[model samples]
Target chain A: MLAIVVLLVIWWVAYWLKLQPPHLLPSPLDVWGTFTKLLTNGAVWEAVTKSLQRAFLGFAISVVLGTLLGLALAQFTLFRRAFGPLITGLQILPSIAWVPAAILWFSISTEAMLFVVILGATPSIANGLASGIAQMPSIYPRVGKMLGATGFDAIRFVILPAALPGYIAGLRQGWAFAWRSLMAAELIAYAPALGIGLGQVLQQGRELVDMPMVMTAIILILFVGILVELCIFAPLERYVLKQRGLAGAKR
Target chain B: MSESTIVPDSSPRAVAERSGLHVPESLIDAATAVSINRVSKSFGNDLNPDGSLRAPVLKEISLDVRQGEFVCLLGASGCGKSTLLNLIAGLDSPTQGTIETPGGRTALMFQESALFPWLTAGDNIKLALRLADVPKAEWNDEIERLLELVHLGGQGSKRIHELSGGMRQRVALARALAQRSKILLMDEPFAALDAITRDVLHEELSRIWQEQDLTIIFVTHNVREAVRLGQRVMLMSSRPGTFVRQWDVDVTGERRIEAPEIAALASEITTDLRREIRRHAK
Candidate 1:
């Protein structure tokens, strides 16, 4: 309550002082008004839905590719020797760094944005899976073999389940990468054929010097990020960890 | 019972014939459930280029377990008791010699429960059954029966973390039993529990062994545990582990851990084990 009150006080003081003029630094209330206006006109819903669809499509591909890559890296020594360092290097490379190549290949279209999202997320997901497999207790495989589990049956019944915690953590990180990469791609490449998203809204607001619109887009991005994490990833992770008795009581 | 009365049978064939009573023809191979023929195990690549210096972890050892027999391998920490158990479980191969088990599959239980954290107690048993090629249709009934056999019964839905240490070991026992193997190899399964809990588990194990008519090869560093559980206890020496001594415990009726005969036998083994350790120091 105190933090909110302090923030409100700062907002009101800034408006009253007319800091940096109304057009450049719009009051918090003006930003709120813009958000309500966007909601009433359905612009916010349209932009959010389009962005979510692209994010989901790209992420789905990443999940399949990443998990397979991770399994290969863990199971085969040749794959580990070949691509392990390259995968780490890709993870460290910023999502925005892929934008130039993505645009060059796909010509600033939805395909280009998707390319960026997949590149941004795949390495983290694969690396997460690899590390999880690597950290699994050696006793598990021996136990599996004693039970007569062999080859793919061992991988399915023993290895995959044992490495789930790390895999899920990787996916969470991958989602973050996918979202940021999508936004970066949107800001850089203005493909009129592709629908407007929050990133595009922010970019348009900058060109028009519409401060309230820029703030509105920023708030929406933050809200979506928090919402997805809380609704999907957090609960999924907690349930899995708790079932394994890896988690303590929730606060 | 004196130390001298507990004699080592150098020839296991004679011992098996003497102990062979209830063993079935199909179940027993030449009246023995397991035959360890001059077995030896070593770690790392070929030891000492010269063949004279043999530092194998387990040296040429020969022993036999009669069908439905309860045998304990007792020694100090580095005695390769676990190594011997692993060789029997087929988890590792002996460097020399052969271990023959005519009874087909064998189940191994570790000191730690080794239960998959992701699986419930029932599911863990079910997985064991599935891996052992038990038909899917019988899994539900078999799972319930196995749980009840371990005294778990309706607690099948409970996760591994929900179980106490003794309960987890019971669940592990149920999982091993799910293999439907004639032999059960336990590596100090009760070593992690409290004294009270260990005592309870010992009774449970003895009861289960009798009920199932299972051949058990239990490995432990504890002397009293061996006396309380095993009909015969085999002691091993540590450095280049070798089967050094054996004691055939002849106790009528169900022997409790605190009984006078059990205590007397345990003390004798403890003295021998201490002497073995002392020899290592020299």
Candidate 2:
């Protein structure tokens, strides 16, 4: 906590000294003022809620679809050989790149945002699950078989649990993709029903030429991203790692 | 050794007579626990239509384990002991002959603990119960019973990573037993442990084996381990694994590694194994 205070002091000093332009990077005081103004209006909160809802909805869909696809890809060699390359290729395409296609298909609505989010996230989720299944030790499945686990029972009792760590890792990566894609979709194409997210706030600030508000929006986006990671995914991942004894040491 | 010495006479009468009073002939006929008949396995394929001959891992191996008997397949490294165990477990098929396990289900324990990291120890055992079609009501009791059998009663809630190697293997043993299979195939289950822990587990395993009255086919490279636990030890040759010799051990009552007969039998088997390896070198 003291270290954080010291770092803030250093940042304040740098800002007072005008190390960079105020427009490109606003002073801490200016960002704080803008933050208070936005907070009072309740619009920022609404945007935040909207963004989170989209990200979570897309993430949930990706997890279910990716898990099913990954299982199919891992289990059926014919399916893997047929579509494995395509899945990987899909993952490499940028989420922002899907905006125009999604807009054309779903036509500027929450559906369009969801399509973008799923497009950006599903491949990673699928890949994570697939690799998890692939990396499981051969002995586990044999042990499963000897214990009379066959077909779906084999997958439920043996395969999924064995592959869970990797699958969880995939979900973490998928969330990142989902969040980023939702932001890009909102920024590029705004819908009245979709309302204003942080991405739109940044666009509005840019159009109004209010550099302080723009900087505030950018900082809030970064802050929200870090906050979600720290609050939700980081703790989740840590719990899993600690359970597996992969965490380095306990305090 | 002659072919007759290499393969045991698996005829029903011979097995019934050899298995002694405890194992009934009706059980032998009805419950020929595992039959590996002239099974040969080799990895890799040649470019030629006739197939390039990769050396065989197991060559014309035939063995029969009667119901409720403890048999150890003992051999050094590269002797294809694990391959044979895999064949019996149906994880892999033999290149030449078929293996018939009359018992519908078999359980296997590996050299490593092989517990799932994502699950608690009790959940791991419960998975076996779920697979075996045990009613959900019985799962809790059955899991506790298995944990008790392995002397790990309070460790059901522990994670695999939290347990020591010995404890993990104990949980693994419990999970395997939870299947309640008629036959249990173990591939060097204790080879990774320290001497003291291995000794303790040997006693634990013997006690469990007696209680369960389950047929066990254990594979190990450890000579003393073979002598210490097995009712009968079958030594295998290296490369193309074939039974080189058999020792019907009579050390019945609380035998230890230092027991005179055990040391003597281990020495004899070790010498036989060394000679077989030397013959291959020549």
Fnat (0 to 1) per candidate:
0.88, 0.84
- Per-residue accuracy of model 2 over B1-282 as CA lDDT, tens digit each: 233266566544564476543544454564677887888888864333575335888878888777777899998788999999988888888888889988657888999878877789999899888877889999999998899889999779998988988999999999888887878999999999999999999999988888888889999989899999998788899877888777667677967999898899889888887777787788
Mark the 10 consecutive residues where model 1 chain A has the least summed lDDT: A189-198
Q: Flag clash pairs in model 2.
A: none
Docking class of 2: medium
Q: Model 2, stretches more than 4 Å misplaced? A: A1-26, A76-86, A249-251, B1-4, B15-31, B45-54
Q: Please name the candidate that would achieve the greatest DockQ relative to the true structure.
A: 1
Candidate number with greatest TM-score = 1
C-alpha lDDT of residue B77 in model 2? 88
Candidate 1 residue pairs in clash (backbone atoms < 3 Å): none
Instruction: Report the C-alpha displacement of residue A132, candidate 2, in angstroms.
Output: 2.7
Residue B33 lDDT, candidate 1, scale 0-100: 76
> For candidate 2, what's the TM-score of chain A, rounded to 2 decimals?
0.87
Write down the DockQ of candidate 1. Answer: 0.80
